[model samples]
Target: MRGVARTTAFLVAAAFIPIIALAQTPAGFEFQITLSKQAAQRLASSGEGITVQASYYGEPKKGAEKHVDEMGQIYLGDERIDLPGKAATARINGSGFEQAAVKWLDGPAMVNVNIFSSRKAGPDNILSCDLIDGELQVVRKSRFAVHCALIEEGMQTELKP
Candidate 1:
């Protein structure tokens, strides 16, 4: 009886070894990147040569917790301000590029990014900024100054209600 019990346990353990091994190994995957010349040129024209550095941070601005109401209006004191994309237009001004536009991504919170450059400015460089809304809300601003020997880092953009 004892010998039979031990043999039964050994057989059960051996039966599960192959199943466990299969579960531990994952199947293979494939990745591909296809970019057209026109699309590549469009991206390059946005701002390619400039090096940009940015850090997103948090702060307690006066209305940091305030957001636009359902009607798309941001109320501050006696005045009512409109939210960007609703009625307000975002105007990006920098040193290098004469023309700039906002490219919005698909998400719950609207994300608009702007990339621009200036060749004749104080510190000729690129600028990238994104306004995001979601679990964590904030406006991120980054600058790439080309001419400054040591570019004085600017303030990190924070979430402003």
Candidate 2:
């Protein structure tokens, strides 16, 4: 009788393995871009007159708690842009979403910022990133529109489990 009970328990556990694996879902977004030659030249000419800004938004899965976490970096001509010590970093929490926007001047000749969130705990969450936008100015005289596009939309997953 004991051997039969043990076999029955093993079968029951095995049956639920797939369900558990399918329950958890991964969530996040990635944004990347390549600057055009003209844009790069304009930035270089601007010298200490250029500025960059970035923002993000996200929603937590059902029954999951929310938290604030984000990271951003800029590169010009394939080289990392050095940020000033006084640069401001923003973080938002609660409200079922998160957002951050930072601005800095006198950056590199050409630049692109890659921003992404850290993994959150729980399932059924969704993350969406908007286009990063800003402006480029030369000696505070000429102003030009600057922006980044999503070269890749990122992986797709089912909306519902």
Candidate 3:
């Protein structure tokens, strides 16, 4: 039992080593990724669906623009260390949803925030959508915002702050 505890501790600590290293680097996103209430409310009340896409230009996976299907799968850089806490529920405009999960990893000169918005399926089932956006952004790290617009399929669109 003690060994198992030790292993879990070691693994958790190991995960942050790279993150700490990235934090030491000169470049990083200045803003933190929190729930944008206005955006969230807009999404919830909108008659049409929503989505966001961002372009990334940095080391590791440089020069790649990624597209997401929904606003929930947003992959942007956030300087804050967002713990993978239990998914919290939010109620906005009488519409609510769970955060589901927030995963992060080392990125080019920064830590990339991977967001997964939980979608309720049939009031009983829950499903995790695909990676909303996946790519390193060295170029737009400082001024990246999730774009809310109508982007046609297979079209490369850069997010606007």
Q: Please tell me which predicted candidate would have the highest lDDT against the true structure.
A: 3
Question: Which pairs clash in the backbone of model 1?
Answer: 95-118, 96-117, 96-118, 96-119, 97-117
Q: Give lDDT per model, in order.
A: 0.23, 0.22, 0.25
lDDT of 2 at 99: 19
lDDT of 1 at 98: 13
Candidate 3 lands at a TM-score of 0.23
Best by TM-score: 3
Candidate 1's residue-wise lDDT over 56-136, tens digit each? Answer: 112222343344344333221111111111111222222221111111211212222322233323345433222222211
| lDDT ranking from best candidate downward | 3, 1, 2
Worst 10 residues of 2 by lDDT: 7-16
Q: Candidates 1 and 2: which is better by TM-score?
A: 2
What is the C-alpha local distance difference test score of candidate 1?
A: 0.23
Off by over 4 Å in 2: 1-33, 48-56, 60-161
- Clash pairs (backbone) in predicted model 2: none
